[model samples]
Target: MSASRDTRSQDIIDRVEAAGLRIPAWQAVCSVLETLGEVLPYGTAAYLASSLPDSMGAEVGRHFPADSSASQVDRGDFVAAVARRCGCGVEEAERAVHAVTDAIAATVPFGVMVNVEHVTPEPLLDLITR
Candidate 1:
């Protein structure tokens, strides 16, 4: 990775770790991105990935197929997916989701996040918002 991307990724990891979720910050962030890959439209995911640090962007792109349509993932299922990916329990997964989303919100533009909120499901809205 480029120096800038590596620095940005570390910044994000530090923010997520500050949330005290116990799981590794990079793992938590990747798990959340993978779970969101199931919910966000491909275009949305692409836009989001573009805004992220290189490695995190690739994580989203890896999980979300360019041609695959997005799903309206239920909150329970979303948490479960994250939990499975992070090898953590439901509560920890939920915290990670919130922390990762907060990190994403900090990195991306406000308009992009507005678009993300528009496509995201109501049940899981709180997880994505600050």
Candidate 2:
């Protein structure tokens, strides 16, 4: 990644930590991106990633669908997956999710996040928005 992009990626981790996720900031940010891979539609994932800093955008794009498909997951499943990835409980996972998503919201363009909102389910929708 370019120097500026690397700096921006670090900034995202910093924001996540500032938002109170207890885990290492990079891990928390990565966990949230992986969870998004499970939940988001292919096009939406690609679009979302495009708006991120280079490292994060590439990380998220790793799951971008060749087949234009995504795994079926609800809010509970999303949190559970994040918990598993982070080796934490549901509540901590939620905090990580919130912290990372908040960071993403602040970092990415508003329109990109709105696309994510439109594709996300109801209870899970609250996670990104909150």
Candidate 3:
């Protein structure tokens, strides 16, 4: 890996570890992102990370806030909303949801790290392998 990627990876690993999530869990999250990034556009992984919910839920209703006027919807709601705004069909929206959920499952234990640079796959995998 390039020096920059190595540095970025280390930074992500440190941030995740500092948030107290288990290494294995973080690894799993990174693995999913890496796979998704390969299949999607360059920024898709970052976009997914930005849209994840703060907690887990079986459905959008369960995770979204009770108030419709809230600035921050549940992470799940935010992602689904984004998909709708993008004009994606049901299956595409579901895929986006899954990508966001997978990311959240990886990071919640650690804490939310919003820095896209930190989680990009080249750096993320380097961090994981080390």
TM-scores for candidates 1 onward, in order: 0.91, 0.89, 0.28
TM-score rank order:
1, 2, 3
Clashing pairs in 1: none
Model 3 segments more than 4 A misplaced: 31-130
Q: CA shift at 9, candidate 1, in angstroms? A: 0.6
Task: Assess each prediction's global lDDT (C-alpha) against the native.
Answer: 0.85, 0.80, 0.38
Per-residue error for 63 in candidate 1, Å, reads 3.2
| Candidate 1 wrongly placed segments (more than 4 Å) | 66-71
lDDT of 1 by residue, 36-109 (tens): 87688888888988989878888878855744433446789889989999999999999999999988888778
| Tens digit per residue, CA lDDT, model 2, 53-127 | 866777677655653333345678789989998989999999888889899888878899889998886668778
- Count of clashing pairs, candidate 2: 0
lDDT of 3 by residue, 1-130 (tens): 5565455444444544454432233343343343333333334333443444311111222322222322222434433444454355444444433444334445444433333334433423322222
Q: After superposition, how far is residue 47 of candidate 2 from its true place, in Å?
A: 0.6
What lDDT does model 2 reach?
Answer: 0.80
Name the candidate that leads on lDDT.
1
